[model samples]
Target: MNNLLQINSTDVTVFVFAGIIVLALLFGFIMYFLFSYRHKQKDFQLLHDQKQQIDVQKIELEKTLRELKSTQAQLIQQEKMANLGELTAGVAHEIQNPLNFVNNFSEVSNELIEELKTERQKTESERSAGTENDIINDIEQNLQKINYHGKRAESIVKGMLQHSRANAGVKEPTDINKLADEYLRLSFHGLRAKDKSFNADFKTDFDESIGKINVIPQDIGRVLLNLFNNAFYTVNEKRKSASDSYLPTVLVQTKKLNSAIEIIVRDNGDGIPKKIIEKIFQPFFTTKPTGQGTGLGLSLSYDIIKAHSGEIKVESKEGEGTTFIIQLPIL
Candidate 1:
């Protein structure tokens, strides 16, 4: 009986210990599952926040691109307006010359007509035949004057019309020297008309041997006008500070090289500074203060000559003067 009771007790203790260990293991598994679920939820929240940040960044970038494109369009429109303004201003200046001639001539003709009528009445009433002859002479002289002024006006109008015409394709066998001379005179005259005292002594030494070349006359004329205007401005600026004894001079010379024609424009004004020489040809670069210059003149002139398979160069020294040398191929 005693042996049976001890064996039953040992079996009971072993089963009880086994049951307690299984319960502990079950509890540990439940706690582990809860902790893992919490960690996964936190990870999902972080990923959602990151995605929102990325979306926000994309929206900002898209806005910036739209703004940039809008700004670019505005700038292009502004440039077009500026160009139109320049063209209108130049056209107005061109029309003023003939209008002035017309006004002056019309006034003179009206005065002459009234004077002739008065003289004829006097001749008829007093039987003064000599007065009638004088009246005829006066009418003839006035008529000639009118014709002269009319022709002058016509020539100016024609020149302007020719200049304003749409450029035909480049023509060959063009006399470059003559074209240069024409532009030189026109530029000088235009400047003189604007300011009567702006006249300076101009000397030309065109190479008679510079044979005809392929060029567009109107385009080249615009280039020459730009260059000549610069030269004129330089001389005029210098003359302002010059003593009464100083005489302003501008020299324009041309020569024919082996395969090209070179033209030189020299002025006795203050030369370009060393520091800014390299930038002079750059677009929108100018030494003139403020409104005195548009700064596009040289840049445009440079481009035009380069398009014609030519080169332009400048040389200068401080306190001395500046010279621009342009070379074009003789085709």
Candidate 2:
């Protein structure tokens, strides 16, 4: 009985040891699986983070590309303007010589016509009185028309020369009144030349006390011309849809201050909308049709005013009128 008990005890011990080995193997397998799963999860998270960073970088690149394109376009526009300025100066100079000749000869021809008329009148006879008088009158009328148009052409050429001059970059003592009046008439006549029936009630009130001011006349002239042109164009557009009783009027006035000069250009025309008023001075912003305007007028004028240590502002009411106020230092 003792031998049997010892043998049974030994068998039980062996069974317990085998069971322990099985459990150890099972636990090892579970740990290996958990570690492998964790490694895969970490890799997937890292990939996700890298993708997000790439997306952000792509967005930034796109923004940078857009800004670069805008800058490039502005540079191109500036280059084009410079080239156009050179071309305009060349054309104006070429036209100026012939224009002077035309004006000079026209004046001389007018004097000769008057002298011929006088001689014909003194030698008048009943034999050919009616025919001779009619010929002389026709000649005189033709010469008068020629002289008038020649003067107009000369004025236009002079304006072109002034506009193309490089003197706009320099400041000199200038007659403000004379400059304003000269440009006002030039702008009006330029419009008239384009549209024969275009007319406006123009008024001016210049302060004589303003006297001479040190300024870049060419630049200021350009600014004034731009303002006048806009005023005329606005009123002309309004006239198209307005009643016959509606008379378009543009008024220009100047005032002398202690240390500054003020110019006000007002027009009875369709005024600017509030939403777009702020954008008027921005480069390439314009209300005019695509081909009718380059949109640089106000922008250039604004820069010019700044360069002169001056200020420009606008006041407008829809359907009533618009006014542009420019203030320049007396210096």
Q: After superposition, which runs of candidate 1 have C-alpha atoms over 4 Å from their true positions?
A: 1-159, 165-169
**Highest lDDT, which number?**
2
- lDDT by residue (tens digit), candidate 2, 189-276: 6676567778887899999999999988777887887898899889999998999999999999999987999999999999999999
Candidate 2 residues lying further than 4 Å off, grouped into runs, are 1-159, 166-168
lDDT of 2 at 207: 93
C-alpha RMSD by candidate, in order: 11.1, 12.5
**Which model scores highest in TM-score?**
2
Task: Compose the digit string of candidate 1's lDDT tens values, residues 1-331.
Answer: 7656445877888999989999999988988888997898799889889989988998998998999778644543343233333334333454555566567766766776786677666745665768657766766776676677667556555645545554333656777777777667666766776676785778899989987888776666666767777888788888889887766778889999999999898888888999999988886788889976666667766877898999999999876789999999987
Q: After superposition, how far is residue 25 of candidate 1 from its true place, in Å?
A: 32
What is the Cα-based TM-score of model 1? Answer: 0.56
Which residue window of length 10 is worst by lDDT in model 2? 82-91
